[model samples]
Target: MSVSQPYPQTYPQQGAPAPAPGYAPQPGYPPQGQMPGQGPGPMPGQMPGGQMPGQFQGQPPVQPPRTPTMAGAAERPNLLHALASESTKLWTTRSTLWLLICATLSMPVVDFAISSHYAGLDQVLRSQFTTDSSISALTALLLYVPLGVMVITTEYSSGMIRNIFTACPRRARVLTAKTLMLFVGTLVTTTLLSALSLFVSHAMLPGNFGEPVANSDVLTTAFRCGIYLTLATMFSYGLGAILKRSAPAILIMMAAIFVPFVVAVVTGAAPGSLGEKLMDYSLISGLLSQFNPQDAPATGPSATGILIYLAIAAAAAIGGAYALVLTRDT
Candidate 1:
């Protein structure tokens, strides 16, 4: 058998034809005439950095995620929205409803008893009607003041205030909302109860006894009683905001209400002295002064003046609370 000869391979000469089209370049190699960092020209509709139009290089332009908005959600919460929120919070709470119901139901029963006793007397004093109506203020001191305290304290206790602050980032708006709600709610509730008490008193008293008092006097007394109770409750609400606790706030409020009167009674503050004037300005004294007959007047500060003073003090306390809320942690 004869051995077959091996075929020899041939090499291409210099300047030979290139590889076929669509062939990938080797690693570490750039396309013809391109720099190290450069790649193939960006595809149609793409920018230099492989980004779409209006996009940055390293990261694509990020848009904030859209959120669903409620009515007025685009707007920062205003006083009216805060007021509506606070009203809903207050009315929805079981404790608030119970306290109001107690205030409403208890007032007429107490007034009727007192009025009947006085009406049976041979001669009833002219101030008795006003006094009977004014009893609701004290009742409010017990029921409504705590209601105000709970308004803030309940949120604190439940850890819900953090969410409230989150929803309404402006702490002052929250405080203002609470104050306005308490003011209006307390005023309306107290006025209605006072009027109801006054009506019951009028029914129990003899027709002749009410004849001397003018209708305006009774209306003025009722309105003033409402104002006082509203201020007192606002004061308590401020205390709650300051302290952030229910028991402590309510106790402090009770002390403010009773301590001055007790001291005045025990020391028998001399008439028209500094002590006497301070005692006169005590909440109890101011409240009693509201029941005085309209014709009998001429005192240092009239009921309205005293109310203004109380209002100033309440505003100051609330202002302090707002300051503290701003400076302190939640």
Candidate 2:
């Protein structure tokens, strides 16, 4: 082994000759202190500054804030809002205005016509004519029915009911609001028209018709006229809601109001028997009962009876409408 040792090799004096350009210093290959894939020592389960894994090193996690729409519904619905919405719709429509005008004008026009017809009659006949003319204000019910029918039916026809229900999901409340508004509107208009007709009829009456007759009878008739118009309007509204169509609702209302009397007339039913009984329950008869003189009992329903019947009908209609609204598709 000592006899033939290999000669020692020598390198250029430029000393390691600088590493090749663009070469990165390899980790742990040529270096002695560093290990493969290891950086400056960080103890197990600990990062720099003693931070644990998933801990925010510099800033906290961001959170989204609640928006107005996300936080809650915009507002709670109530009767007042419903009333405003309905009243706006009621007044804005051309048909409403026209119907109201017709309703307002009808009583006076009919009274005038009737008065003119009986102008040459005796004082007793003229007084009777005046009384009939005042009661004729109830005829406005024909117009009132259509007005009420259109109020709700038009919404269905135009698809506004979807928007209405979307805004106010309580269907019963919506119906109640509409009913209240319609009642008040119809009452005011009917009352004024009825009063105007009474005034005109009295003014035109011969002096022998006896100083306009401002007794309990006259007051009762006037009050009943307003009540009748209001109730009739609600009745039609209920029918409209139940039917949900304008033409059918109007036709049904007409039949309900007019058909009984028409049938009785066509058949010439006896005054105090079955024919009279049918007439008694007819809508027109119920309304006219309110105008019966204090000395005479009504052949039809009393005022209280009329109110009860109308109330029941309206309730049934509204209840049915509400049920249908909840169960049916838009």
Candidate 3:
């Protein structure tokens, strides 16, 4: 058999189109415009560095997600929120409204009745009556004590305290806000009522019983009355917190204000230093010192006594309340 001659093979005339400009062939790569296993290379405007125009380089660093922490929560307790809540509670209660109205009107009504009763008395008697009538303003303290007690006790009674605690787990902070609201409310109300009583008594009475508005004694007495009411309210608030019951707290507060006076009066008639000592440390006596520093009970607490006792009681109550709140379950 004869063997046929091998045919001559032909190749590209332009050497595979010159491999395009700036193109470099990588081992196993198809060509400059094609990928190893994919279709075309990156679209136009793409760089050899594998980045497109206006594209960021490389990948952004990954970040871990955030988580909640106790410190973050504790940092967000809002005192203003507590204040607003207490204020709303104070103004919205019917008992609070009625008690406030009575407190405001009681002084004027009682003073007017006293003045009318003594209208025919001589100037000396009338002046003495005017001086004595100032004590009627203290009557507001009776109402204020109950009001302060109810401020917290009502919440306890209705189980709203649980909600309050939930909203503000810092028990002492909650009590403090309530006390502040009570003090402010009582301060404004009692101060205005005392001033009004003074003005009305002077106007209704005869002779020089009407003192000048700028009288140092009158201004000092008015200022002291405000302080007296504020301290008394705080004292009652402490009692409420300590007792956590309205009736008991109210009874104890009343006893604190009146029992000493009763004992002092009953024993004062006898000849012994016991009665004198009781009168000296009495809360009312301390309050009286604010009105007449000179006439303050010779044996009883001074003006500073009121502050000292109230502060101690408030601090103790707050500590106890905090302990209970933290240790006890809702």
Candidate 4:
């Protein structure tokens, strides 16, 4: 006897539909007769033509970040950007900070000590005291020259000059920016230091031995001293750019600055001789003359003339640096 079919089977639960006739659902296969590679048309949220909404059915959109373009004039960095970059680099370095600190403080400290020394002297002329005090500002050069040289050499040593040149292909513009930055920075710092040193020196000396800080002569001399320091530092900077090595550049700068004194001492360049005339144009000589006109030779270049010469020399050095930057590879 046919065993009772277990409870007369009812497929696909009550009210649930069954698979279509002649089509059997299988685990890994699509519906019968449908192409093997065909999918169930476009997915939801996609357009009928298989395009996503808001996306055209064409090649992928251009990605600007990945696209390459040659740098044009408009793309090149401007002077202001270069100036700001140089300023940041200048102020951020620890060597720059320490060197500047020494340069800034040396003037006031040396001036005070000198003025105090003069205070004890019985016969100190005001000109002599002022002259000594003004000369004290030159002590800062011991730090300023290295500071200037490092400004360029540090970049070279660290291989940063390559990046800088790459960014601003107009190398002359970069050099111009550096020159302006160094000039302004050195000028402002040295001028303020000179003014402060004047006040400090005057405070430590008797009225007869030192001019008041408010004296027009004191103000003018302080400003001139600042100009001297600025120009001297710029000269060192130009040497740095040309040499591109800190040690050699510093050595050359020191020789240029102090060799005259050495020559004068060793050879005793007779007064009014050509050698002596050349020494008169040295940085220290012009500075001394500026501080005390009496120290200047009667027939030699005046302090103003010496400063003009210094300015001319500094301009030539900087111009040469800019030219070399254009011609040489970073």
Determine which window of 10 residues in candidate 2 has minimal summed lDDT: 289-298
Q: Per-residue lDDT tens digits of candidate 1, residues 78-125?
A: 899989999898889887778878876777888777776675565546
Which wins on TM-score, candidate 2 or candidate 3? 2
Task: Give the number of the best model, judged by TM-score.
Answer: 4
Q: lDDT tens string, model 3, 1-330? A: 999989989776875664468667777777765656756657567665667666577955445798878887665658788898889988887876677777778877887887777788887777653355456766777877787788777888889889988878787778778877887888887777766776677677766454555455565676677777777777777777667889999999899888987898987735447777777777767666666677765455666666677667756765676677567765
Which residue runs of candidate 1 sit more than 4 Å off their true CA positions? 1-78, 207-213, 272-275, 293-300
The deviation in Å at residue 5 for candidate 4 is 32
TM-score of each: 0.72, 0.72, 0.70, 0.75
TM-score of 3: 0.70
1 against 3, candidate with superior lDDT: 1
For model 3, give the 10-residue run with minimal summed lDDT: 208-217
lDDT of 4 by residue, 49-90 (tens): 666678777947444575455654345558999899888988
Q: What RMSD value applies to candidate 2? A: 10.7
Query: What is candidate 2's lDDT per residue for 1-330, written digit by digit as tens?
Result: 569879999766775666446657665463334356677566577677656678787755445696668438656657899899889988898887788888888888888877777777887776664356544665688888899889888889899899888878887788778888998998888877776777677767665344645655555566777877887888788788878898999998899878888888777768787667777688877766665534222576666777788878877876777788678866
The Cα error of candidate 3 at residue 74, in Å, is: 16
- TM-score: the better of candidates 3 and 4: 4
Model 3 stretches with alpha carbons more than 4 Å out: 1-77, 209-211, 269-271, 304-307
